[model samples]
Target: MTRDGPDNPARPLAGTDLCALADLADPGSKGFRFRQERLMFAGFVVRVGDEVRGYVDSCPHAGWPLAAWDDRYLTREGDLILCGGHAALFRPLDGVCVAGPCADQRLSPWPVAVIDGRVVTT
Candidate 1:
């Protein structure tokens, strides 16, 4: 878990609305940030067709952010999640690092779900 401080921004309360399903691109991704004073939480959501998965944005190999730009977490084909920091490839569905310095490692899951046409914390 990427704990920043006493304020656990990384884990939003269940049912917190993230974004509309329609706003999120199919086979695309979106980045999110939560803050409390000096502490900040970073995460991202990957949407593949009707499935939406969330993960902590930090890379397992170096603890750096995975994406260099906002909403640019997926590869060109949008089939896998790409770490902008080290060119790591991860499975969107399971956040598994299939190849890279952190092979066999996995991205921390950030519980989320699509509810009533909206993405929300779960």
Candidate 2:
């Protein structure tokens, strides 16, 4: 279900198997869009170690998704989430803007949890 907000408030995950926890490997990202009421909701998922995090997929610099063009949302080492469009880098822990042009800026975060080996919205 989609929560109404530029605020991107917490919303419960809908359906199942949006993706498996293991599916979000380094350099890989996933996107999901859900509809609720009259609103359309969108988010991106990133895998880090044994956990996963989700975000609105928007970069604070240009208000665009961080990936270059596809699911490649991270640097080669997979520690920093990169916005190839502007060379901005973000910390995975809280989607904090950490380097490049948008340093001190931040990406909007969406709540995520893992259940039954599947990544889910929380």
Q: Choose the strongest candidate by TM-score.
A: 1
TM for every model, in the order presented, reads 0.92, 0.77
Q: How would you encode candidate 2's per-residue C-alpha lDDT over 1-122 as one tens digit per residue?
A: 44435543343355445788777775467877666556566678887777688888677788765676667777888888898788888988688888888899877887778898988766
Query: Each prediction's Cα lDDT score?
Result: 0.87, 0.73
Stretches > 4 Å off in candidate 2: 1-17, 26-28, 35-40
Clashes of 2: 0
lDDT of 1 by residue, 1-122 (tens): 35733257555678889999998888999999886655677878999989999998889898989998888999999999999988999999999999999999999898899999999988
- Worst lDDT run of 10 residues, candidate 1, spans 1-10
Alpha carbon deviation, residue 29, candidate 1 (Å): 0.3
Error in Å for residue 54 of model 1: 0.5
